[model samples]
Target chain A: MTKKQTCIFLIIVAAVIAALITGIVLTDGLYERDATIQETMQDVVLHERDKISLFGLAVNPGLISAFIVTGVILVFAAIVRIFVIPKFKLIPGKFQMLLEQAVGAFGGLARSNSPHKNGFLGAYIFAAGAYIFIGTLFELVGVPAVTAAGECVILPAPLSDINGAITLGCLSYLVILSGGIAANRLRGAGRTLKEFSLPVSMSFRMFGALLSGALVTELVYSYLALSFVLPVIVGVLFTVLHAIIQAYVLTMLTSLFYGEVSEPYVKKPKKQREKKVSSKTEVVQ
Target chain B: MPLQLAAVPLNIDWQQILLHLLNFVILFAGLWLLLYKPVRSFMQKRREHYEKMDADAEKKQAEAEKARAEYEEKLAGAEQEIASQRRAAELQAEEYGARQRREAEELAKSILAEARADAARIRAQAEKDARADVAAIVTDAVEKLALKESASTAYDQFLAAVDAQSAASKKPAKGARTEKDHD
Candidate 1:
C-alpha cells in the first residue's frame, strides 16, 4: 500500500479503538438513579414505584469532550507547524541539527543499498512513514487526549461510537496523509517503499516492546499504594525510555536501508582500474 | 425476579444543545484555522528544505569527484610526457656521445697516418743523401787514380821531357826557342 493509505488505515483503526473504549466508560452510569430524585418525587407522584429513563439517546459528554480535545490538539499542532516553527527557524537550531543528523543517518542507509541518486528520497519516505506510524500509536494510546485533559471518556461494546471514532480518525488520517504526500512529491520516484518500510517496521516493533515494558511497569505500580507523584514520575520515565528506544530503532533501520541502496554507486578503485585497462585495450584494437 | 417497567417524562433543552453544537463547531473551526494548517505547512517546508540541501550536497560531491578524476588524468598524462621527454633526452645524449667518439677515432687515425708518412719520408731522404754521398766519394777516388797512373805511363814521360827542356831554355832563347819548339 502507499504511505497515504497505510497512514489512513492506522489512524482509522486507532480512533475506532479509542472511541469504543471512551463510549463504554461514558455510558457506564446511564442506568443508575439518583437517591435525591426518589425522595423529592415521592409525595408528588401518584405511582411510587415509577422510574424514568431521561436523556436516553443524548450524546455522551465524555465523547464530546474527547472530540473537542482532539480538535484543540490539531489546532495546537498546526500552530506549532506554521507559526512557532517558522518563528524559531527550526532548521538552524538544535532541533534542526538533530533533524539533519537524522536525515544524514537515514541517507547514508539508503545510499548503501541503491545509489546516491535515490538515498535522499528514500530517507525522506522512511521518515514520513515512521512519523505517521508513531503518531497513530500515540493517538490510539490516548496521549493527546490525556494531554488535553486528565480524564477521558470510556465506551461500551456492541455499539460503535462512530462519530467520535470517525472524527479523530479523520484528523489523524489527514496529518499522516499530508506528511506522506509531501514526502512522495518531494522525493518522487527516488524514494522506495521498501526503504521506508524498514524503518517503519523497526519503529513499530520497538514501540510494541516499549509499550509492553510500560504496561508491565504500570501493573507493578498498581500493586503498590504509591503516591500520585510516584506514579507520574514512573509514567514519565517509561515514556522517555519508550521515546529513546523508538528513536534508536528509527535511526538504525534508516542507516541500514541507506547503506544497502548506495553500495552499487560507490566506485571501487580496483573496478575503475579494470575498466581503464579494458578501455585502453579496446582503443588499441 | 420481576421486571419493573418504568417511564418518565423528559424535558428537552433544544437551546442548550444548539448552543453546545455551535460552540463545538466554532471552536473546532477556529482551532483548525489557527493551529493545524500552519504547523503542517511549516513541517512541509522544513522537510522540503532539508531534501533540497541533501540533493545539492550530493551534486556537489559528484562534481568534486569528476574534477578530481580529470585532474588525476591530466597529471598522469603530464608524467607520461615527461618520461618520454626524458627517454628522448637520453637517446639524444647517446647519439651525441657516439658522434664524438667517431670524430675522436677519425682524428686519431689521421694523426697516426701523418706520423707514419713523416717517418717514411725521413727514411727515404736519409737513404737518398747516403747514396749521393757514396757516389761523389767513388767518382773523386776514380778520377784521382786515373791521373796518377797516366802520369807514370809514356805520355806522362814525354810530357815530363818537354817540361824539362822548356825549363832549361827558358831564360836566353825565348825568341829562337819559339820557332824550334814549333818544328
Candidate 2:
C-alpha cells in the first residue's frame, strides 16, 4: 500500500477497534448474572452446562462441534469435488496448488512411512489429519448452541472432550493393529498388543493438550477486566497453537505406528538357520 | 465401570464414544470419496502422462540417432565408391597413355628406317649416272685423235662431245620415265 492508503487503513482499523470497545461496554451492562472464576473454571473442566439434546439423547458440546466440523468439511469437499477439482490444470493455480500440496504431503508421509502398504494408510492419515485440524479450528467460530439446562454456550473444540479424543485415539490404534495384522498376521497383532496403553495415552494426551488451551481461555475470560482484548490474543494463540501441535503429533504418531506394524516380515531360510547353528557349534567347540 | 479420577469430573460414556466413532467414520468416507481419491488419481494420471511423454521423446531421439548413423554410413560408402572409381579411371588413363607412347615410338622408328633406305637408293643411282658420263667422254676423245686434228683442238672436241653425250643421256632417262608411265 502507498503511504496514503496505509494511513487510511490504520484509521479504519482504529475506528473498528473503537466501535468494538463501545459495543463490548454496552453489552457488558446487560448481563443478569456475573460469572465468577470458580464457576467458569468448573464449567470449563466439567462442561456442566455444555450439554445439549441430539435425537433425544444428551450430547456434549464436542459432539455438536464434531457434527458442525464434519458438515463444513463435507460441504467444502463437495464444492471442490463438483466445481474446482474439474478445473484443475496441469499447471496449477494457487488454490489447486494448495490442495495438491496438502494431499501430496499426506501421501508422501504415508509412502515414506509405509512403503509396502501405503494406499490405505495414505487415505487414512489424510482423513485423520483433516478431521483433527479442522475440528480444532472449529472452536474459533464460537457458534452458540442451547444446552440441555436451557443455558446458551459456545461450542468448543471436538477433541477437547474426553470421549471424542478417546474415539480418535482408539480408532488410530485400531488402524495400526489392522495394518499389523494385514502385514504379519499373528505376529503383527502380537506387536500391537505389546503397546496396549497406546490408545489411552494418545487420547489423554490430546484431551489434556486441548483442554489446557480451553482452560486458559476460560480463565482469561473469567476476569471481567481481562476479558476484552486479552481473551482475543490468548484464546487465538492457544487455540491455533493447540490445533497445529495436536494435529501434527497425532498424525505423526499414527503414521509411525502404522508404518511400524505394516512392515513386511522376512523369514530366514532353513539352510541359513542350519548354517548359523553349525557356526555357533563350531565356535563353542 | 468407569473409574473416577480425583478432583476432575470425567464422564466415560460408551454411547458418546460410539457416536463420535460413527461420526468420524462418516467423515472419513465422505472426505475420501470427495477429496483424497480423486485428487490422488488425477495426480497419478498426470505422472503417468509425463512419464509416457518422456519415454516417447527418448524413442524418437533414438530413432533419429539411428537414422543419422545410417546416413553417415551411406555417405561414407558413397565417398569410398567415388574414390575407387577415380583410381580405376586414373589407371585406365595411364594404360592408354603408355600404349599411345609405344605406338608413337614405333612409327617414329619406321619413318627413320624408310628415310635411310631412300637415301641409299638415290646414292646408288647418282654413281651409275656419273660412270656413264665418264665413259662417253673417253670415247669422244679417241675419235678426235684418229681424225689427225691438232692436239688442243682435239681436246676441245672431246669436251664438246662429252657435253652432247651428257645431254643425250638425260633425254633418254626422261623418255624412259614417260614410257613407263604410258605402259
Candidate 3:
C-alpha cells in the first residue's frame, strides 16, 4: 500500500483499540452498566418535591428547570448578539440565514394576522416560542438536579408545571390585550375582555401536553422491559414532538386572536334599506 | 387515591409563575436587541444602496441619449448647409457662363462691322486712282497726232518749192498745187 494509506489505516486501528480499552477501564469489570437504570428509578420513587424557599414560596423542580432554561436562552442570545450579529452579511451565512428565516417567519405571521401590525407581539411570540420549544427539549438532556426535599431527579420541562404554564399563558393574554388596546383603545379592551377564559385554556393546553410527555417517559424509565433502548427513543420523540407542536399551537392562537381583537372598529350604517325592506315585507305578509 | 394521585399531572405553584414571568421579560428585551434591530438595519442599507445605483445608471443613460440626439441634429444641419452651398455654386457658375457669352457676342459683332467699313473705303480709293491714269493717257495721244500731221504738211510744202524750181527745169510747179489741194 501507499505510505499515506498505511498511515491512515494504522491510525484507525489504534483509535478503535484505545476506545475499547477505555470503555473496559471505565466499566471496571461491570459488563452491563445500563441494566441498573430501571432498578435505580424503581428504588428512588421519583416525585417532584417543592422545597426551594424564598419569600414564603416553595420553588419546585419545574422552577429550577425553568431557571436553567432561562440561563441557557440568555447565554445563547448573548453569543449570537456579540459574535454572530456583527458579522452578518447581505448574503447571509448558514447560521445567520436560519436566524433571519426564523425571525422573518414569526414576524410575517404577526404582520399577516395583525390589523394595525403590532411590533412587540411578534418579538414576544418569538421569545415565548423559543422558551416553550427549548424548555420542552431541555428535559431530555437528563441534567441531575435536586428537589426541595433533597431527592435527585432529571430536569423537567418548565411548561410541565402548571405555574409556569399559567404565567406564560397570562403573559400572552396580556400582550394580546395590549395590542388590541393600542390599536383600538377602549373598544380593544372590551373585545379582549370578551375572551376571558383564553388564558385558562392556553395554560391547561401547554401544561397538559408537556406533562403527558414527561409522565410517559417517566413510566417507561421506571419499568425494566422498556427501559433498555426504548426510553431514549420515547423520551426524544415525545419531547421533540411536544416542543414543536405546543410552540406552534401557542404562537398560532396568540397571533390569530391578537389579529382578531386588534381590528379597527368601523361603524356600519344602521341597516337602513335592509331593515326597511324586512319591515315592509313583514307588514305585507 | 393512589391511582387518582398518579393520574393528576398538574398542581398550583405560585413561585414558578412569578419566576417564569420575570425570565420572559428579560428574554424579550435580549432578543429584540440581538436579533431584530441589527438584521433589519443591514437589509435597509443594502436596499438603499441598490436603489441609488439604479437611479445613477438611469441618469447616466438619459444624459448619453441626449448627447447622441444633439450630435445627430448637428450632423443633419451640416449636411443641409453643404447642400445649400453646392446649389449656390452651381447658380454662380451659370451666371458667369451667361456673362462670358454676352461679352463674346458683343466683341464679334463690333469686329465684323469694322471690317465692312474698311472694305468700302479701300474700294473707293482704287476707283479714283484708275480714273486719273486713263485721263493722262488720252491727252498725250492727242498731242502726238497733231504734231505728226503738221510735219507732213511742212514737208509737202518744201518738196513743192523744190519741184517748182526744178520744173522750171521740168513740171514740179503742178505737183506743188496738187499737194496743197489734198483733202
DockQ of 3: 0.32
Question: Of 2 and 3, which scores higher on TM-score?
Answer: 2
The true-versus-predicted C-alpha distance at residue A102 of model 2, in Å, is 1.0
Instruction: Compare candidates 1 and 2 on DockQ and give the better one.
Output: 2
List per-model TM-scores for chain B: 0.45, 0.47, 0.43
Model 3 residue runs over 4 Å out of place are A1-57, A228-232, A270-284, B1-9, B51-183
Give the interface RMSD values of the models in order. Answer: 11.1, 0.9, 2.9
Candidate closer to the true structure by DockQ (higher is better), 2 or 3: 2
DockQ versus reference, model 2: 0.56
For B1-183, candidate 2 gives per-residue lDDT tens digits of 543333344866778889999999999999999999999988998899899999999999999999999999999999999999999999999999999999999998898677656555654575587577677677667766767888888888888877877776676466545644543
- Fnat for the candidates in order: 0.12, 0.78, 0.68
Every candidate's lDDT: 0.46, 0.85, 0.75
Write model 2 residue lDDT over A5-24, tens digit each, in one string: 99999999999999988998
Predict model 1's lDDT versus the native.
Answer: 0.46
Per residue, candidate 3 scores C-alpha lDDT tens digits across B1-183 of 123333544445454567888877877787677766666566668779889999999999999999999999999999999999999999999999999999998988797667555555554554454445344443444454466657566556545554544445333334433434541
Candidate 2 residue spans exceeding 4 A from truth: A1-26, A32-35, A268-285, B1-9, B71-76, B95-183
